[model samples]
Target: MKLKTIIVEDEVLGQKALAGILKDFCPETIDLADITGTVSGAVESILKLKPQLVFLDIKLGPNTMGAFDILKSLPRIDFSIVFTTSSELPENILKALNKYGAKKYLLKPMDIDEVVDAVDCVIAECGHDGTLLNIDQIKNIVQEASQQHVTKKVSVPVKSGIEFYPIDEIIMLRSGLNNTYLFHTDGMTIKSSKNLKFFEKQIIPEGFIKVSRSYIINPTHVYKYSKEDGGTIFLTNGCTASLSGKYADVFFKMLNSST
Candidate 1:
């Protein structure tokens, strides 16, 4: 099925470029529904047309009517979105976009092949009922993409300089009074002055799970889960961490989804 698509961009050149790319490369998969520059117009068009896909620009207009605002104003998000932006987005915004079921995040001066790939990925994953994507499917897609994007390394700030850790070598994180301790697979531990929340926002995208208020673990290194001991998780590196009952349900849910 051809996805009913809309472009919400203010720049004339950007609009032309994106539309041209879709026409040239993704003609069979996408049907251009409409194009609008403002958040209000985009929201109205989406509400009226109920298009299956949207190419949304971050800066629709002033502060009150940004792309995020349009999403927040909607009663329900039944359509998928591909965020088109010129600037590199902040981590918080990226997390929000992923949470809001964005199908893809495209940087401007867009590449035709990337556009085609995004369209193809969306088309291949959509439901047969003509619903392009639901929240769960989008979350899975975003999570997978995030894992791929963060596979190689993670940069951590240290007192002397920055330290880079191979993502696979990391075992888990333990929260401290005002800092967080990172345990590695190679019998090394590093303490960063940043809090658990900081590391959570940074590395959770890389498949780390917060099993409790003070512990975030790499499921890849999980040796065993001991339910008899109030849900203690033992790592492959002979380290143990407690999984709180309060967060157990969501932790298991995420674990199941990943598997």
Candidate 2:
């Protein structure tokens, strides 16, 4: 099915890059609707065209409000989103996007294979049944984004579905061979599809500290710290995680600053 799609990017080059990909690779699946750069123009075009999918960029020139403003101004979100972002974009914004129902994200400079994969997924997801946010949820997302709110919950994508964990309920996270394991206060460990670095980016602002490459611990659950055995973090859950020398200085600095 050819999806009526729009590209909402500030940079002329970004707009052309994705547009070129669609025109060249995905001509059968994507019907290029329109491209808008400014927040006002995006809002106007989206309202007029009513596209099924939108390729949205996080930054719009000097407008720090970014894509969230365009979303907020819209009447409703009936279309699915494929967020286009750079590596430099903050993780909190990434969290916000996921929190509000964005499932597809593409990092720039865009790869052809990844772009194609995202479009195929969008057609499948949006074609059958997909998550779309309402105006109220959009407002909350924008508010959090603007205020730079530290999230209280972390969403972990699992094999079955997404799992939501209260930040306080988490004891520590350990990196496994393929995925990350999350230890909670309930004595259950949930496995997340994302890596240690993914969780670190999302939860570090919420007081979860990466004590080692293998582990990230919630300081609120710290029972004690022992300098013995190289270094180790003792948690209230009666679990101990090894602290690596690599992150020891930063961890120590955090402890010192909190005092």
Alpha-carbon RMSD to native, per candidate? 16.1, 5.9
Model 2's lDDT to the true fold? 0.82
- Local distance difference test values of all predictions, in order: 0.78, 0.82
Residue-level error in angstroms, candidate 1, position 64: 8.4
| lDDT accuracy of residue 39 in candidate 1 | 80
| Runs off by more than 4 Å, candidate 1 | 128-259
Q: Write candidate 1's Cα lDDT for 168-235 as tens digits.
A: 78899998988888999889999887677766655677778889999999988888788877889989
Candidate 2 Cα outliers beyond 4 Å, as residue runs: 1-4, 9-28, 31-37, 44-51, 57-68, 72-79, 83-118, 125-151
Give each model a TM-score: 0.50, 0.66
lDDT score, candidate 2, position 100:
63
Steric clash count of candidate 2: 0
Tens-digit per-residue lDDT, 122-214, candidate 2:
777775665567789888877776688454677787999667777789999999987999999989999988777767656787777888889
